[model samples]
Target chain A: MAMSRAVLEGRAEDTDGRLLLLDPSDNVLVVRARIPAGETIRVGGGVPVPVPADLPLGHKIARRPIAAGEKIVKYGAPIGTATVAIDLGAHVHVHNVKSDYTPTYHLLGGEAGR
Target chain B: MTMRGWLRSDGRKGIRNTVVVGYLVECAHHVAREIALPFREEGVHVIGFPGCYPNAYAERMMERLCTHPNVGAVLLVSLGCESFDKRALERAVRATGRPVETIVIQGTGGTRKSIAAGRAFVAAQRAALDAAPTVPMDVSELVIGTVCGGSDGTSGISGNPAAGRAFDMLVEAGAACIFEETGELIGCEHIMAARAATPELGRELEASVAKAARYYATLGYGSFAAGNAEGGLSTIEEKSMGAYAKSGASPISGLIKPGDLPPRGGLYLLDVVPDGEVRWGFPNINDNAEIAELIACGSHAVLFVTGRGSVVGSAISPVVKICANPETYRRMEDDMDVDAGRIIEGRATLDEVGAEIRDLVIGLAAGGRTRSEELAHQEFVLTYKSFEPIGPACLPAA
Candidate 1:
């Protein structure tokens, strides 16, 4: 089965040690490892983009700018829609992207802005 | 790969020649378990229908299990008063030419006398199975099933997709591969339908997920667990999109209910939700129930993918544990077979890990015991449920 290049090479080892664009059409990138604020990381084969906030492992970061109510694309499909505008390199998670099926539940009382 | 297996009268092959001591009801469970305890060193394992009341579904499940490809003989323990049809169970096992004996607890002077008799019956069956004729079985004769438990965010990105890739390889090899849990697959029905071999099969797959969604909604709880949320998943759809990855890219050939064996070798979906009104509490109480269903469907072994890490094997079939989380793998290395989380860490690619899993499954089928089996994790659970018979469309080829 010939899948997209992004699907095939989604786990390709990144020399820069940064994010993963699972699909070429994906709007979000999975953080390969934890990143501190202000660290520049590659996004979607583009120039290095500075990390705007601290990101946790396995969390998603917007590869490109996403407007509020726009669908958040990961694994080449819509996981959810952004609740607010998300800039490139900004974190994407329950605080921003809300599931289309059910309410997103947060464990911690809304304090950290990611 | 060719493996030596027991050739049954029904034209099925068994990888393991196991003798089962089954209890007819909860009252006889203790005696059955005791009988199996002394013989655990051998192939004897305890399995039973705990419910005392008459349920066609339960009886059918037991019948299928007693005649399962892995079982060589059976010793049924009856309380002697329960509505469970011991004679029918005996006939089912007998029809397969496997030795079967039923000891009525009340008639045999209660528990002490029955346990001794059951133990003696099992020893005789073991000796008999040792002398039974065996035949060569091919990979095409193999039926493999997969299920995920303790799923986390990494599951979709790594483990489940790796299992999917393995499923694709197995299906391409002409092996019958089954991936289930329509409840977890609720959100990906559209994509799943697109991969169906037939348009009608696509519709059936969609309807099965819809039924699961309705059943869970009425139960007032999605299948989502607190572990899923802590692992970064927010809703059922997000979790479902990940869970749906285990099916691989094979075109679905059929949809079958529990105990409904796949008619031919290919990819099939197991529709676990009960038909008609929601009489049973939940479609599957836990992962073990689904594993048991897979075993009853004639799977010689099971591939159990986990993220949070579960150390569980089935009563009859061997379970190959594949760990999806690198962190969890580090914590529970002894319990897992495949380290699929390496894909996330760039230690390996999905295709590489997938091949590893495929090889491991083939090896397991050829008589290698998995880590769960070595640890004696023979977990079994059976609950009450109702299922209407499937229509001709369910297994069109059969």
Candidate 2:
């Protein structure tokens, strides 16, 4: 998928027609829209990496292969640490990453609960 | 722009002339609620401290709230046995020259008599407030607050930043602007500190965020909830970054606590986290508690940015809801005052939405009701907390 000029007009960083790079130093990209598994997303004009699962809108996708214990950077800051090794284009979320500052409370089975 | 405002004896201007009925303790909440029930649509609000224990913080908060600029009159309902200092609360309101009356449920022939007395006081005060003289209020005299609740991923790039832009414009126009949630701002302390007006104030800002981090850490939660994760936010710091954007690109004028009002027009950070040890549960149990704190700090109006869609307005002030996610905006359009999600959909730029917010605020000051106000969403909440007086460096001569 080709990135439209309108989407990239005001944005400082480039997107792969699916992911939005909030900051140049970020290690992950925000999903602009929902993306299905096997869809390709290119980072920094590099080789396209196939998404491992269906990525929901506003969720994050890894811009590069991340080792376990490495910091997950977003908005040019370390949001959390990866709990397990994550390949590029893999979803970065609660199941695979955890907060370094405090515990994140989620319901059983990773379902959304207030 | 200038608008007609209810001028208080303290020389403060108010966008809304409200009569607040306060309960000294949970035991008196029923009487207070009944007193304000009939006049709910007439700007009569119910607010109170539920704790029976004597808390200095709660006392100070009550004092500030009762004397708030927006409050034209006050009615205090006491259970006659609670530890809360009802006398001092009444005296504080009286000192503001606002008509204040207190009814003790135990002494005033129990619940029925107290409710009737309280309602009579409120009714008379409400009539008097309608006749109160109005003064011309300038935009520079307004004190505005911003907070984001039920936030999702879209909040950061859209609603929050658009609100930030609005804050920038408000500050530039000489209005006092405040942005808070230190617990959620843990990771951005350094970045925020660098924007402080002075080095000493910067250090104070950093220490405040550190306190929040430590306080939440001790509680074993980072203010992150399952809803945040479900909305695609993974960590507290990630949410913090999004929350931090609401402060806009302005030099930090000062640091303040919940009840501390900004001295002049500029951007200030309200540290909602309590000082010292983490004693009283969460800093703010819910969004309305924070909104109440902002109102206590003399905010004439609050700009609420949300992605998950919160429909709560507030007592004594109006809440302008800015919806972040395009889908959520579509789902809750009637409740929202601004569709900041347009930035996400490429339908509008941040500046356009920001200008719209500023214009709407001016319009609200001129008696234009917000969506929340129109829906009669006068939610209020107060909780226990502790804080020491701010240090010299906190305000930095400003």
Candidate 3:
């Protein structure tokens, strides 16, 4: 095989595309491109999955249901905790998954995120 | 579609045409510059490492890089007091049939005298290259490397994935692509290992990442920096996944060290984090060091993705900048080759942006000027380091 597999889907369709699911064992999918609304994305297998809105790359997508305050598993490691309950294929990013351990910094008037 | 490439005497085909200058020690840097500076009119590119310390790996890297297919000629500058094996370096370049010359500053008198002698050497070298015929090149002959610096949350989203698309196209065209820094790959080890062509290669991949983890843990830093926290990344592994995507979707053929050339076409990983207990302070002090290592590995050109916007390029190879953040792109479009941030703006598709990157690589290989090159962003730096060779496990079949 190759060093990494192309998603059954690829090249983010809109402003946001799918993050990568490097392994089937991975609980969270690393977004490959920004996900835009009104486009089909590959949620995992079977068919091209659709999105609610744009989800940026490097952000995670829920492979399964996750509860509020539950650890958000990505690449099998806890990237953060879900600030709110997450459903299958939910977009998991700073707005949703907040790091429980490391404190995030923000510049005044600059807001601290992508 | 398949592409053609220029074959070198050393049996490697390069994606771009480059000229390199070698500085034997920190003291001769001024002379080396004065030598190549006059030839700036003729696409005579200058690259060299300034080091007084004698390093086997350093010397070998220089030889290999000098003989790389991208390079058409080499000029070595020595101050006469350093330990760099100038004679051996010149011999290696000469053996490749690429014109090579060395000027000793002390023997020639001083900076002014050496500059005159060096300028003469550079003139002759450029003249020879001018006489060299341009061949129709193919994509399979391309050897490209990717790395990210000044990364922010946007980098992984827009910049890196766009590069991944470009990588996929280049690989499909039969190019040899490389992605590196095992320390960053710690969390993604299992994913990286599984892609190995063989189980033995998988084991080596895992071990390299493990070594990086241990090394970084000792240094009191994760590969993910404080800025990454400020930018939205949570862990080193997360950062690695972003960087790793730059390798594209090609099947990996083998594992190679900093100066090792790929035995065949496909993707390879450059284990920049040294083997054994880390003797060097940091295997690479900054991004340019990593860029230099990529050049040494036979990379004809490099794709650099940035979310925070870094503006440096390497001396020997061309650098193509891919910007991820929309805001950053707006601020740095003049510096970037691909405005991948547009992908995040809903204006461009991943495939569209990726194809642009692929076309840009071909354009650059066909002699189009990259923004980095046009700006003359020729930066080079090297330091002392020791590395034991990789065992047989680091190959495709092994």
Which one is best on TM-score?
A: 2
lDDT of 1 by residue, B1-398 (tens): 55778888899888888998899899999999999998786788888889889988889889999999989999999999999999988987898888899999999999899989998999899999988877877888889999999887778778888998899888998899988999888778999989887788888889999999889888867777766765666567777878888888888898999999988889999988888888779888999999999988889888888887889998888898888888889999999999998887878888998899888887865767789888877788888888877766666553
> What TM-score does model 3 achieve against the real structure?
0.81
C-alpha displacement of A88 in model 1, angstroms? 4.8
Q: Residue by residue across B1-398, what tens digits does model 3's lDDT show?
A: 33334568866766555567788887888778777786664666666667777788889888877887778878888899898898999988888888888888888898998888777777776777666666667777778888899887667656787898888888888888888887767667787788888889888888888888778766766665556654546556567766777766666677788998777678888898877786777777888888889888888889999887889887778899998877778888889888988766557877888899999888876667689888888887777777888879787662
The CAPRI class of candidate 1 is acceptable
Mark the 10 consecutive residues where model 2 chain A has the least summed lDDT: A1-10
Candidate with top lDDT is 2
- Give the per-residue lDDT of model 2 (tens digit) for B1-398: 55879888888898889999999899999889999999989999888999999999899888988888888899999999999988988888888888998898999999999988988888899898898888888899999999999988888878888888899999999999999889889899999999999999999999998999899989888877667787788889899998998998989999988889899889999989988877899999999999988888899999999988889999889999999888898899999999987776778878899899999998887879899988889888888999988888888483
User: Residue B283's C-alpha lDDT in candidate 1?
Assistant: 83
Provide chain B TM-scores across all predictions. Answer: 0.97, 0.98, 0.95
Candidate order (lDDT)? 2, 1, 3
Candidate 1 residues lying further than 4 Å off, grouped into runs, are A1-8, A11-16, A34-57, A64-68, A82-91, A95-98, A102-114
Q: Which candidate, 2 or 3, would have the higher DockQ against the true structure?
A: 2
- Backbone clash pairs for candidate 2 read none
Q: In model 1, what is the error at residue B25, expressed in angstroms?
A: 2.1
- What lDDT score goes with residue B240 in model 1? 84
